[model samples]
Target: MYKYDEIDQTLVDERVAQFRGQVTRRLSGALSEDEFKPLRLQNGLYLQLHAYMLRVAVPYGVLSSRQLRGLSQIACKYDRGRGHFTTRQNIQFNWIKLEEAADALADLAKVQMHAIQTSGNTIRNTTTDQFAGAAHDEIEDPRLWCEIIRQWSTFHPEFSFLPRKFKIAVTGSPNDRAAVRVHDIGLRMHKNAAGEVGFEVIVGGGLGRTPFIGKTIRDFLPKQDLLSYLEAILRVYNEFGRRDNLYKARIKILVHEIGIETMREKVEAEWLTSRDGALKLPQAAIDQIAAHFAPPAFEALPGGIAREYAEAFRTDFEFGLWARRNTAKHKQPGYSIVTVSLKKEGAAPGDASAEQMAAVADIADRYSFGEVRVTHEQNLVLPHVRQADLPAVYAALKAYDLATPNVGLVSDIIACPGLDYCALANARSIPVAQQIALRFRNWERAHDIGELKIKISGCINACGHHHVGHIGILGVDKNGEEFYQLTLGGSADENAALGDILGPALNATDAVDAIDTLVETYLRIRQAGERFLDTYRRTGLAPFKEAVYAAA
Candidate 1:
């Protein structure tokens, strides 16, 4: 919850005015579609299959009640009565008109939010763990560094347009909730052997047409040299990254072409020149940035289980299940992190209706210190909820249909807006996701099957993060017919790995059955207390692939 300063407000307002004029000229035929493409993209507007789509950035996935209300208003007034939360922890309006794009951005600026850098080839939103400040296991609040990088990267002259789009993620926890390993650059904060805080810098990690688990370039970098090191990495990529082919233009491909050892040498050479330059952060500045992310006022209470929470769990079986699945331990006594699931049965994943947004905003204000967080898994988090308020929060969410208990289960899927909205997509991902969700609607059965991640992408672009799911589903068009390809053992956690292809692509109609077969195979072969991923890792792909293809 960093409040915008005067400089931040002024820059956003100016950008809105500039884009408004640009939009006017484009509508008046002063600029053609080809000429206007970059301008619109710079403002986070895309021409999709049906209409214009506008993406709004939620920095580090953090939002205040006021910002959530602003998004709800935009969804109610300008576009449809809903908005789609993305895998990158941003929100998208799929039915925006070209004329209203600037107006939407203007409204966003009023709430200290903007759509800038949500798209295009510049540094996109700098994301981090949604539970950054509240998580008990964190070494430091990663959002402090995320905000520093956000200001440094915005409109930087040298990196405004690179070889391809870049993404950066930071994690303060050892558990890696932010999916740091799959980003263009991943920063993990930890203490060194001497007990001094520093970063483990990983670069060249990404997933698209090609997937890679980023290699660590710097084992331990001093905290003060973050910007200098990042500048060096970007400089190397800007100069040497491929630009001729869009498919091979990402920094991941560049790192692949040159070995990690050579890439590290080049970055180290570049870093020597910029280490003490203007980008080198002073301790005072770091302290100033850290002040903005200080912990909220918390009351001291008993650390053990609360009486009300225990009673609710005993009385209500459904609430007990949801509490166990969707809540995480909070660092402060009597507080918990409550995940509000958007993956209700038969609905589009990560989508929230206008009314639901308003309801969530209200709940956040009343029970979670007026703050909400969007997770990379397409869920919302009330990071500071009191244990005593659990029942009330659950009841309110139930009224809004936001209390699904499937946080990491099979039905809690991740999907992109496929052919339904995206022009680049060849097949419809939403329908495929919906079919699978419906097939797994039995909550008890899904819970019994244990933790599983099912991610679906409309194409190879991997917007859905299909490559990192425990069960990855990619939609492909073969000879004008839609087919679905499956991959297994992919994970985006502390043990990050790319899923291997299970077998040949199966027809769209048979995709759900194939998933069932895979799940059944896992259940039969899994050892005691082993999760889907653990079983897959132990048993390998032979069992799951054999079952899926046999059913096919």
Candidate 2:
């Protein structure tokens, strides 16, 4: 909810104009595809399987109703009549034309949105907890710092171009909703002993061809030094991160090669020279940016909201399960975080049709103070909904085919648009994801299955974040055919750990059964009421792994 200032608008406008000119030159053949590739990529434009895909950044995943409506317009006007919300809290239009890319960007700028940091080797969209200002356990609103970081990193002259892409995730809550531990630079905010707010900074975490849980370089950095500390880290990465080998060029590899001790020392030395310089965070500036995230003037609702919500749930078992999963604890007494599931039985994961988009807008207008968020989980969030309104919201959403009620269940699959759509994909992911969802369509059965994060990716690029799922399914090529590989025991919590491969790959037809075997084995062996992840940790993947590969 960081309001744009004149400076912010001007910067966005300039970037759009610059990219527009670049697109013009590229289309005119003055700049060849080879030459224009990097430039266009820097602006978040990519030529996909069918057409150009334009990724539009939704900073910190926050979107006003107006902005969401704008995105709906872009999808209808420039590309397909729909858009794909990505795990990074942004949306990708998969059918944009090369010539229409600039116009798409221009339209985005009109709504205080752009694809500025949606790609390229720079600090990408600063994601935070989807329930940033509303989460009960949060120390402070993290989006304030995210917005500050966005401003600092936008076209930062010294760090604009780097050996590899840089990603930063911030979390104010103890819960790791943004998967901070799996980012290039992760910031966790907490109150220090002296009642001062500071960050526990981690570096080197990322998910792709090589997944790494970033190591903590500094346990606690004072808030005022946020920008300086980040600048120093980027400087060390820019100078020492691998450049010769693209495969090993990520900061994680650099951290791994140099050792955490050496990386920490280097970052500290860089910080010693850079802290309090131009990048140092000022109290006034921080306060000014922080002001935009001030909590909405929430009216006092009746305390019976919880009772009313439960009554509806009691009457509806499916709605009851959804309330338990999709809704999160809100900071206020009666408010709740409502996740609008895009994964209906047959729709592609993370997709919102033009009509569904407008439905979300309408829901936001009626219940959520005209604000919504695109979570890294690829679901729309009404973060500050009143508990009393849960039934009505659920009803409205159900009418729009947005009410899946399988938030943390196995059917809530995360997948990238793979071979069927993306040019870079090696295999199909969406169909596989759909198959899994269909396999779990029995709400009662899915509800019994319990909490699990199933992430899928078409190829190693990991656009779908397959590396972080409790049950990770990665699509790969086998003799010009598709094969699905499974990984179990991954998590993105405070104790964030990447999942491990469970063994050999399975053909597309065999995958759903394989997953069912794993889940059934988990249910059989797991302690009473234990979650899938918890059971996996306590008993190890041996049980599920053995069962999955047993008679195959």
Candidate 3:
């Protein structure tokens, strides 16, 4: 985890002080709601349907036990008693009072965290794989680059107010867990023919009204020129991206309209001018940042499954199931990555109570070197848990309802707050997700289904990343009634592709049943060892569509 320096501390403190005054003015009638809108948004505060929502950034999804404790305190003291972890790996408090917003931020600053650039057209949190430092197959830890980008873009005057919000994601592993291809700028780390690692810079990828799997603008970008290349892309978008229509404002829209070839030409022209400038990262500077993220000290433990882990797997059937679904291989010997599933049956996805958060903090401190990670899938992670302690970690997590062994299963659905919380939402998403998750409560059936990512969004904003889900559901407003439109064959991996929609929007109840029907159809027709996504890609939408609509 990267700790804040003097500069980082000062900037966060100043922002807190600045926003505190802004809030005071708004309360004093010196600033009206409309006047304070942008000011508050710049500080990551939003006025939702019923209350104010505060989004706190968790850069690259890394958090210390101390920081987690700070967030837990803020959740309990300032807002509601829970925090919602977002798809971007940030956390949100749904019920914040305007007067207390500043105090909450002040508290966050004490822990070297803040909500800066979390909203309002700025480069929002630069995310990466949750297992960045710990993944065994990583070419290099992407968090090192993510942090560099964060330092460069924090207050860059040129990109402070782009035509629309921007997002960037990085993945160092061949298996893209960060969903890099669905970002405005996706940087994939891989080795070249010379056996040197560099980034594959993909541009114009995004999800919303118009979803796209970003095009590869540069096949291999050297690590040294990262900042210069990013500057070129932003400059091109800032100058040429639409400002006339809000709907057409994103860089993706500009790429769609002008074509990626032209977009590339403009960016390349811009890069030529900036490549050798101060923005070019030198080896010394890179090393300075890299030093901050060096791997944690590890004991000289032997490799392979620990004796305790094997014994538990043999004797405890429930433990065996949980271990298989929730744990992942780590880079270090005898250590495993534990994903704490937030999507328990019938509960809202990605939400954790203050108590639950504190419990995780304690668990991390005791067994995982006090470090935790928030995943893009909206789950918490104990990134360095020893394999010997798997049972203990499972027991601790199970006590708080966090041990829902469904990491990539049907019940582990990703969904936005939807009509339940978001003001822009036209239909309810939480209830729909809950209903669908409940239908897949059978552990045998869910495990059998295998690696189905069901993402739901209240609207086309794609906050829940519906466009990249294996089975995507989008809520729609139809004559004041809530309905859902389904899309299948979508995935957010290395071979990322936008989902194809199944015909027609179904009412909420019908939509839930349709998912069951779709799964049943896949199970019936799929060849041996085929997952839902594999079956969909093999058979296309015809079979699943026929099964769903025919049942309706």
Candidate 4:
């Protein structure tokens, strides 16, 4: 919802031009792969297993209908008729010509989009809760702050080339839908006793080969000093942070090695000097950004227990399932946030077909006032849908294969495009994810199984957030065949915790069965009303592991 001003447009144009030159140099052999790898990576171009993959950033997963339509065009023209939305709230064209990346970036700029900072060891996309503005219990729309951070960090002079990439997540919701606690910098909005709004800043959380839950650096930071405070923290990391080894280079490592208390001391020392500097935010600027996210003049919709709504659920079992899964609480009394799950049966997760994209845009236009959000969970959000029109919306989505009701269920998996598309990947991820989804196709079974986040990344980079999945699966290639190693009890939520590995790797073909075994075993063993994570936390891995491996 943040509109690009002339300055923003100029920045995009200039970056595109810069990348054009860089790409030209690479193509002309003036810049070898050694020189061009970082340059191309910075521009969001990667040479994968088969072809070039171009990742375009959709900041905080927000997109206009026009932008979505443009992406559909890009998918149809440059890619294989679909673009894969990433866990970082970005879209990737798995098949792209190396020569056309600059042109592709230009096309993106036309719609006020770009791929800058999507990759490389700089700050990546700042993600927020999908239902930011429309969520019922938000302190404020977090995307406003996300946009402010975007402007402040974009191509920053000092922090541009860091030891490792950084990620920041914010959520206005108290429930922590954005998984802020697992980010490099996690910001949760809250109000003090005096009713003045502020942020709870947490730092050092990340998921990779090493995963950590961020520790609270500040109990409460006034909204006005957000940028300056953030600057102080970044300055501490930039100046004193480790850079000797890439693996030990993130701020999380710094926080762990230096100890949270010492790190806090260093950050406070820096903040004392930088608090009133130019980075200190202006009240007018914050208000200006907030204006863009103003809620629509939503008239009170009929909240009665309408027979039509009830009948739709009662008669159509599929509609019932979808409504149960795809809808979230809305700020307005009778409105709901309708999540359009991109992960349907047997297809790629987060990869929406052109037709599906258009249909979603149509739904946004007709029912939700032409605003749709691409969520980090690889789904689309019609942020404000009337409770009465749920049936009609469900009917419309049913036609496009977007009506899958497996949100937060086993089938709603997050997976990266692996060896199938990515050269860096050691094992194929999409097919394995599809197999797991197909295996758990039974609606009753998945619902009974309850919430599970199964993320699969092909390699150790953890692009799919495999480190954070309730049942994290990491694919590895042993010799020529693929195998998967599983990690359990991981969660990305209000109680964020990285999973621990259960045991040895499973054969590639047996991976889905392995996942199915784990879920079924949990169902049989869990206490009443306990979810997968809760059971894992309570009972530990021995029972599930015994049940799973005992059969073998």
Candidate 5:
């Protein structure tokens, strides 16, 4: 994790003080709601259905034990005793009082965290793979560059008020855990044929009322030119992106209208002037940022098949199942990256109670070098757990109801706050997700079903990333009635694709049964060892769609 220096600390403290004054003014009636809207948004405060919600950024999904404790304290003191982790690698406190928003910001500042840029039409949080530094197949640590972008884009005067919100994601691994293809700006780090490292810069990728997979503007951009090139892209978008209609204001709309070739030409022309300017990174600065992400002090252990681990796997069936589902191979031998699932059956996805947060912090400190990671899939990762200690870590997590062993199964759903908390939502999302989870509560059945992603969003905004799920559920309001539109064959991995709508929208009650029918159809038709996605891809939507709409 990057520690804040004097400059960083000063900036955050100043922002906190400014927001505190603004909040006080609003509460004292010196500022009206209309006047305070932008001010509060800039500080990551949103007026929701029943209360104010405060969203705190967890940059690139990394958290230290101290920061986790700070979030727990906020959950305990300012709002309800729970926090909701979001798809953007941020956390939200749903019940925050309007008057205490400033106090919450001040508390966050004490831990080198802030709510700045978490919302608004500015550049939001820059996210990366949960297993950034520890993935076995990573070409480089993408967070090194994500942090660089975070520092550059935070409160940048040029981009502070874009026509619409912009998002960026970086991925060092070819597996695409960060879902780079669906971001406003997606950077994939890779080595060329000559073995020189750089980025494949993809632009125009977004999901909302309209969904589009980003196009590669630059096939290969030199590592040192990242900042200048990024600036060029932003400059182009800021100048030409639509400002007339809220629906057509995103950079993706601009790219769609102008075409990728023209967009690239403009960006390249802009870059020629700024490539060697002040934004060009120096070798020393790169080294400084990279130093912050160096590998932990790992001990030498046997490379393959530790005796104790093997014995435990042989003896404990449940632990073995969890190990297979929740753990991934680390770059270092004898170590693993363990995902702590927050999606316990029938619980809200990506939410943790204050006590659970504290317990996770304690476990991280004792077992994983005092570090934890939030995943884009709404899970947490202990990045450096020793293989021999898997049993103890599993037991500790089980004690807190965090060990669900359903990392990629059907029940490990990703859902947004929807109508439950979001004002923009047209229908409820959490209840829909809860029903689906409860339907698939059997762990053995869920694991057998295999690698199904069910994402739900209360509206077309796609905050739940429903557009990319294997089974995407989008909530819609039809004449004041709640209905859900289902889509199939979407994926967020390397083979990123948008799902196709199966049929007409179904009533909320029928939606769960529709999912059941689709699953049953898959199970009956799947070939040996084929996952849900693989079966859907091979068999197409006809079979599943027919089953889902047959009774309707």
Candidate 6:
């Protein structure tokens, strides 16, 4: 994790003081609610259905143990003992008091964290894969680049307020775990014919009322010109992106209106002006940023399976299941990336209690270089855990109720805080996700129906990223009743594709059953070694649609 320098510390402290004064002014009648709206939003506060929600930015989803403890403290004092990890690799605290907003930010700044640029119509957090430094298949660590972007874009005068909220994601692995294709700007790092690593820039990919898989604007952009090219793209979008209507203000809509070719032409023309200017990154500057993310000190353990890990897998069935589901390959010979699943049966998809957060922080400090990571799938990660420590880590997590063996399964749902919390939501999302997760409690059955992603959105905003789930459930209001529309065959991997609707809307109970029906249909007809997504792509929507509706 990059430690905050003097400039970063000063800026955060000043922002905290400024927001504290603004809150005081609002309380003293010097500022009206309308007047305080933008100010509060710029600081990551939102007026939700019941209370104020403050979103704290976790840049590139990396956190220090000290920062996690700080967040846990804030959650205990201000929020109702819990925080919700979001799809964008940030955390949100509901039930915040308007009077304590600035106080919470001040506490965050003490730990070198803040909420700036978390909610405004500006460039939000730049996210990347949870297993960035640890992943075995990475082309390079993307967090260094993400940190560079973070420094450049935070409080940037040019893009402070774009036409709408913009998101950017980066991935260094061939397998797209970060869902880069669904962001405003997606950068995939790869080596070209010359064997020099650069970015494959994709633009206009977003999920909202209008979902789009971004188009590749540049096949290969040199590392030195990343910022200049990004500036050029944002310049094009800022000049021409729709502002009259909120629905069409995103860059995705702009790209859809004019083809990718024209968009590329404009960006290239704009880049020609700034590519050689101050935005061009010098090699020394790149190294300075890269040094912050250099690999953690790793011991030279034997380059094979640890005896204790293998013995635990053979002896403890539950531990084995959790290890198989919740861990990923690490680049270091003896290390593994452990994902602490927050999607326990009947719990909100991403809610972690203050106690749980503190416990994970302690665990991370003991086993994983005192660093923690948040995933886009709403989970916590210990990115550098040694395989020898697997048993102890599992035991500690199991004590805290964090050892749920359900990653990438049906029970591992990604859902938005629907009507229960959000003022914009039309239907309930938490209850539906809870019910569906409980339906798949049988481990044997869940493992058999492997690698299924079920995402739900309260409305069309796609906060839960329902557009890219293997089975996407969208909540809609129909004549004063809650209903869900299902979509099948969607994926957010390297082969990104939007799901096709399976049928008409169904009530909550029937929607849950419809998911089961769809799963059963896949189980019956799937070929050898085919996952749900592969079967769907091969069979298309006809079978899943017919099965779901027929059951209904």
Clash count, one per candidate: 0, 1, 0, 1, 0, 0
TM-score of 5: 0.99
Task: lDDT for model 1, please.
Answer: 0.94
Output the worst ten-in-a-row residue range by lDDT, candidate 2.
Answer: 299-308
> How do the residues 405-424 of candidate 3 rate in per-residue lDDT, one tens digit apiece?
89999989999999999999
Please provide TM-scores, in order, for all candidate models, with all chains considered together: 0.99, 0.97, 0.99, 0.97, 0.99, 0.99
The top-ranked prediction according to lDDT is 6
Rate residue 485 of model 3 by lDDT: 94
lDDT for predicted candidate 3 compared with the true structure: 0.94
Q: RMSD (Cα, Å) of candidate 4?
A: 1.5
Error of 1 at 184 (Å): 0.8
Instruction: Show model 1 residue runs off by greater than 4 Å.
Output: none
Clashing pairs in 4: 49-423
Error of 1 at 74 (Å): 0.1
Candidate 1: the clashing residue pairs are none
Please report, as a residue range, the 10-residue window in candidate 4 with the lowest summed lDDT.
Answer: 300-309
Each model's lDDT comes to 0.94, 0.88, 0.94, 0.88, 0.94, 0.95
Error of 1 at 455 (Å): 0.5
- The window of 10 residues in a row where model 1 has the poorest summed lDDT is 543-552
